[model samples]
Structure formats: C-alpha cells, structure tokens
Target: MTSAAIIPSTDLDRPELRRPMTDPFGRTIDYLRVSITDRCDFRCVYCMAEDMTFLPRADLLSLEELDRLCSAFIAKGVRKLRLTGGEPLVRRNMMSLVRSLSRHLKSGALDELTLTTNGSQLARFAAELADCGVRRINVSLDTLDPAEFRRITRWGELDRVLAGIDAALAAGLAIKINTVALKGTNEDEIPSLMRWAHGLGMGLTLIEVMPLGEIGEGRIDQYVPLSLIRARLAANYTLTDLPDSTGGPARYVRIEETGGRLGFITPLTHNFCESCNRVRITCTGTIHTCLGHEDASDLRRPLRASADDALLSAAIDRAIGTKPKGHDFIIDRRHNRPSVSRHMSVTGG
Candidate 1:
C-alpha cells in the first residue's frame, strides 16, 4: 500500500478558514483521541471489568470511514491524534491504518500522531510501528511486581509486558510508561517505576485514578492524588517542573539527577481544563466533547450514511461549540451519583 494519504496536503488543512474549535471556556480543541476498537485482551481492574462486552464489528467505524473522519477533523484544525482503545493492537491489521496516518504525519498534515497500548502485543509490532513513522509509544503498566500485575490486570503477565518494553527499546521507539497511581496500591512503587523508566530512557507519567466509568466500589479507595505520589517521590529525589511540549494535560517535571522526566495527569485534584485541548471519538463514531461530561454527538450518521464531510465537520464543531469548561466528574461522585457512567474502554480511556 502506498504511504501517501489520499487527502491532499495543502487544502486538506486550511487552518485559517476553519474557525478555531474554542470551547465555551476558550480552550481550543486541537487534540483528537480516536478509539479504534473496544476489544482488549487484558481486563484491568481500574479500566475495565472482568467480563466485558465489545461492540459488534458492524457497529464500528470502518478504517476507511475513520480515515475520512480524521481527514475532516484535520481540516477543522485537529493538530494531534492519539490511537487508543480497549487495546488498539487487538484490532486486526491496525498497521494499515497506522501507515495511512504515518503518511499524514510525514507530510505535515498533523503535528504528531501517537498510540497508547497495554504493551501485551508491542513485542510483536514495535519494529513495524517504528518503521511506519510512529516515533513514540506509551505503554500502560501499573505495577512492576508480577503478582500485583496479575491482580491489577487480572490476566496479563508481567514478563510479557517487560518483553514488550524491551522490543520497544530495540526498535528505537521513544517510549513513555503510563501508570495509574492508585491510592493504596501502586503509589509506593513510584520510586522504583521512576528508576526503571529512567534506566530505560523512557519518561514515566503517573496518572491519578479518576472516577471515570465504574470502579465496582473501589472508586474512593483507588483515587490517589498526585500530591501523595509526588511526596513519595520527593523523599528520594528533587523534581523540577518542565514544559508540556506535547500539549497534553500531563504536567511534566525533570527528575533531578537522571535523564528521566516525570508527569502527573491529575484529572481530579488539578483542573487542567483551562488548557484542555482534547476531544474523544468512540469506535462507533460518537464524539465525546469532554471526558468529564457525557455531552456527545453521534457522527456516524453523517460520516457513514451520508458521506458528507461538511455535515460531519459541522456536527463535530457543534459538539465543541458548547463544550463544558470543566467536568463535574469529581463533584458528581461526592453528591448525587449520575445514573449513567461511561466505561473507560468504550470512551477509549
């Protein structure tokens, strides 16, 4: 298959003509997180339940349809795209799509294109992903202990994840480790994980366990604030704040004596919504305007049935136009619990 994207490079991204997708609070929506599939191999306790039901293959946006939607978003001023899922690699032959987007990145149609995975299958696909113009990969690894890993994910083996990390390094892919810092669980392992990630020359991002989706009664107990984790890490080393070069919400810091960088994605305690720049699209083509709220627009109708880029783009713009400034995700959990909670997997967590 040709590496060139079917979309043209010039008119494909007329940023000036497109009205900047500014939310009601004035945060420009430029990052697009696309869920390729809701199917995953491992069921992480924090992210998904043991027995999960995935969407039917027919219900998902076709790869070509996704490409078209991405084209529309790009024209509308989406600068970055991250491929996420229940496990993006679980989708069959995803490299085709990667190659397709890689061409866009190579041609400057996007500022960056990245992928987030559980790393179970990275050992097999790392080299190809690197060769296809994917410069960076983020692997979700909550614990370094084998038993704890098994307990957290309920199925994945730590050895496989380690092998995937090795393969990622072998392929020369810039890597990041995303660990959910659960309150009583893995916060103590922060130093060890930081050391190991720095040893591998990879930056580690500690994400506070958010109240998103259902935690099955473990929500309160699992919520670990970044303050606690930072305090724990501070005992061992000093951390200096660094710039968030990638436009992500993760507040970065340079780990004082090593080549390591650390970041905290505190969705709860630290409200980064003032600079929030992301919008999520589910595998079935629903545009989630904010991860904290349920405001969404079903783009599949216009995207697939009508094949009208104008309609699809307008639908997305409408969703962003009224985007909530901040999610009451934490507040709602404190008082009246909403009857409906969005599953992190379905929303591409």
Candidate 2:
C-alpha cells in the first residue's frame, strides 16, 4: 500500500463515498480513537517521563477540525468514537468537542460516544459529559492506595480522582476502571482493586505493561503478565472465560466469587491484533494504522488542504489498506528502549 501523503489531491473522487472501512486483513475498521491533546496534568511513571516534553498546542487540531475529521469517519461507517488525551479534560473547552460529537449519537450515526480519561477533571465535567450523551466511560486507575497512587501518577491527588469517580457514578455513567498491572508496584493490590471496583458496580480491567515508549525506566521491572494474574486469581476464586468485547483488546471473565465481570488486556502474553477493528489518530491529525507499528498517514494536510473530505477520505482508505495483520511487541530484558517508540498517551490510550 502507498502513503496517503503522496496521493494526488484529485484521487478517489468517485460519487460512491462512505464505503465501510475494511482493512486488507478483512477486519472492519469501525472504531476510531482520537487524541485531542498530548498534554496531561499528571505524568504517570508507566506512561511518560517525569519531565516530559509535549507537543505544542499549535500542532493539535482545533475542535472544528476534529469535528470534521470525526464526521468523515462516521460517514464511512465508524460506529464508535472515543476521545482520549494525555488527559482529555485538561484541555480547555474540551467539552465543546464532546458536545459537538454527541450529534452523531443523537442522529444514530454513531452507536456510542465515549472517552478514556484519567478522571482528574471528571468531578467538574462528569455532568456535562452525561448531558452530552456519554453513557459510559473508561477511567485509568491503577491502585486505590493514596500513597501508591501519588507514587504512580507523580502529581495526581487520589482524593480528587475518587471524588470525580463518585461524581461520574452519581451522573449515572457506567464506569470501567482500567488498571495496568505492575510487577512490584501494584501487583499485590490487584485483588483488592478488583473487589473495590466490582463492589461499586464498575467493571475492572487489568492491562499488561506494553513495550510502547521510553518512560525513563525498564518496562521489564514493571511488566506483569495477565496470565500470571489470572492464575493467582484462580487460587482464591473461580474465573470463567466469557465472550465479551467492548470494541477493544480485552478478554473478559466472570468472577463467581464477586459475581462481577473482569477484563484482561494481555498485549505481550497474548495479542488481539487479529481482531483489531480500530485505528488511532494523534492530536496532530496523524492516523496510526496499528499501535505497534511506526507507519502512519498524514491526514492533517488533506484535512486542512480543503474543506471537502474527498482527499481526507482517500487518505484514510489508503492508510487502512496498509493495516498489518498483527503487531510485534516485545519487552526486551536487556534494553531500556521499547519495541514501539511512541508513547501510549500519544496513541490515545
């Protein structure tokens, strides 16, 4: 497949627009994860460096541009739209984007409009998000301990985040807690965290530390395979594998003890690339076809070149055509570098 940047402006001008986006591997690309900003309030140790350099605000697409780009995707059969960020709520006027995108949900073009947030600003924005038609959201919370939370996030306030979660729950939003299982840090707290989330009627998902970016430390030390977590859980409770997918790379299981659902995202021990039906777009309007690959298509130029989406749509199509069947993610024991150099926050997750 060719790069969309090199494609002529006049290419793909056919009247038959809005084709269902399907990759060469026959996976229907229906989910789009868009990063509104690369700036976060707290610098998580596993996600980014403590003193990190972020993209300038000028490099990020404006709210209007994001709306148009997302609309183009919805026109092409993207049923789900998720807005993400280093911390999406930290962005000024971020709710404007959410409120605008809720139009798709109202029109029935989009099945769901949601967000993956760190829950720092959810206390202030939870009501607005629910008013804008966000029924469910994913909050990334690794540990429930306040001191450990401070150690992990570096700048996050545990009480503030908990208050935000309470506000979201009070707003009637279905919440899913995403925890990254760290070997020595939060591994011991996994069971307690799971029980806390399930006890509150929120689903908890444990994710393996992926080799994605240089977080100024060795991922080998932080990595904890979900297989091991499942094994440990089996010693005390029964875990029944369940066929459940939330349009992402997670396998679900029913814990008979808690009578609640649990999810595991094992990118290193087991990959879900074969069933990947989503792609991510950065704040700078670059479309990454796969999270593990460096190859990307520039949609900003086409998006800014013309108001019409003909060139932008063609670029998206070309990018999807190049989607690899699987990704190569390995955490090197000897190296501090990652297999994929880009940070997970850059790719919106």
Candidate 3:
C-alpha cells in the first residue's frame, strides 16, 4: 500500500490548466461510479465465472483513501455519486462511508447519492442505508422464479432478495429493478419481472447483455434486444410513452393505469454511448474514462501525495480529458478488446 503525501493549503487555489473534454454527445460527464470493494458472496453468471479469482484485501483502496478521492471528485464538478461493487453492501462499515458522504452532501457538495446492489443483502442493510441519505437503489434480479434464480445466480437466496426489496420500499428508498435480458436464460421472465416490479410501485430497467471481459464469451448471442422486449410487453399490456422523461440510454415507458414505469437499455443494437455522461473509479482508485474502454488514468498516487485542491482538480481534468468520444463495440470485438478489464465485480457496473 502506498501512503498519501501531505501538502500545503496554498497550492489548492492555482487555476487548473487542463480543459474539460466533451464527447460527441452534449452531456457533461459529471457522474462518478465508485466501486468500494471487489468482494461479493454470490457469484452471478453474467458478472463472474463459476471459478473466479478475487482481489487480495491489500489491493483494495482504504476507506479513508476512498473518502479523499470522492471528496476531491465532488470538488471537481461531480455532483452525482453511485457506490457500486461486486455488491457494495458486502463491504464492512459501508454505512459509515454512506454517512460520511451524506455529510458532504448536506454541506452542499453533492447533489445525488445512489447505489447498485445484487439485493441478496439489501434486507439487512436497507433501513440503515435509508437513514444514511442514499436516495436510490438499483437491484439486479433477473428472474422471478426461485428455481431459475438459483440456477442463474448459483445461490439460493431468492427469498432473501425479495425480502430485501420489500424492506427497501418500506424504508422509503426509490427502487429500480435491473434485469439483464438473456435469450435462453431469463428472457421468458421479462413480463413477470415487470409485473412484479410495477405491482410493488418500483421502476424496472431491462438491460441488453453486453460482451464484457472473460465472462462474455458464450453470452453474446443471448442478448435479447430492447425492441423485442417491448414488443412482447405490448402484446399483453398497453404501452404508453412518458414524454416528460428525458431520453438517454434507456427508453422510458409506462403501462396504462399502472403507477410504475419501465426502462429499456439496448447497448448492443441501439448504442447509447452518444448520450453517455458518466465515468467510473475502480476499487483500487483507477479512473476509467469509459466503461467499454479499459484504459484509465491513475489518480490514487497524486491524490494521496498532494492535498492541494488545484492539483487534484488538474488530475480530474486530465482524466476527463481522455474520455473517449464513443465506443466501437459493434464493429470491434468488445469481449476480445485488450483494453477491457478482467472483472466487472471490481469495475462497478
């Protein structure tokens, strides 16, 4: 582990020399997704192989170091923060970090704070997290069938996950159910998942399976496009577009007379990279300019070595300066791309 250097406060005021880099899309990259830990109890097939390698404890960023990085990012125009991981709740004292971040937010440093979890542990942590100022949660649950859930996740915690979802709603956390639509696996469960989420008064998002890293080898053909998902839903349900919602990656629609809405993310067939406005910070403090691209800027070293805000700001500027215009996953071999990182668990989805 490397120790951070302390510097004088006078250096923080220097004007940043770097300029913000904009992609072809007009959206400014102000959102930061931080992966708190790579450790998770359940092994989902889409995110991990049956036999997967885990990062050593010494390799992950310390909580204090993570706080420093996050504080600096907030100062650099990052208003939205999403804490993610193999499952962020698996990190011990995660609520402590959430509390600290809430303080920063209360002080007007951050505008929004959210998290993405597998929901296996949400029942235990939902209330505590709600008290910590986490406003939203995105839970990954592909199937409503218990047998298929166990088969897909390789774990028998389906009941526990459902309980967690109920707890989150009770705790007043805005919930979004994220389901990855795979052809032979969980495609048949889309309507069921949507109906369940809607009945619970929660939003639902169906994501097209993308070819990510080593786990993506046999999963490419399983991607059931968003168009098909919508068409299937239209057969039995009346689909109405919510025009007030802004268009980005997901196509937002609502079922008539239903209180809940649905979202569709078709990255493979319909690229959303043009409207992408987010970057990610890996568990080890590497700044990823794009999710599809693995090349990243190292900010841990400079952040630890300098207390100067200007220097920190400059480092952020440099990271965003390298943000790519768009990814070429369609023409290029995304799974085989040398730049793609090995594990999504550590990278933060």
TM-score attained by model 3:
0.89
TM-scores of the candidates are 0.91, 0.95, 0.89
What lDDT is obtained when candidate 2 is compared to the true structure? 0.88
Native-vs-model 3 lDDT?
A: 0.76
Clashing pairs in 1: none
- Alpha-carbon deviation at 286 in model 1, angstroms: 0.5
- Sorting all predicted structures by TM-score, with the top scorer first, yields 2, 1, 3
Q: How do all the candidates rank in terms of lDDT, highest first?
A: 2, 1, 3
lDDT of 2 by residue, 1-349 (tens): 1111211222223456577899998999999999999899999999999988999888899887888888888888899999998889998877877877787799898999999999999999998889989999999999999999999999999999999999999999999999999999999899999899999999999998988888999998898888898999999999999988755789999999999999998889887888898999999999998988888889999999976777788889999999999887898877668999889888877
Show where candidate 1 strays beyond 4 Å. Answer: 1-19, 331-340
Candidate number achieving the greatest lDDT relative to the actual structure: 2
Clash tally, candidates in order = 0, 0, 3
Full-model lDDT for every candidate: 0.80, 0.88, 0.76
State each model's C-alpha RMSD to the native. 2.8, 5.5, 4.3
Cα deviation of 45, candidate 3, in Å: 1.1
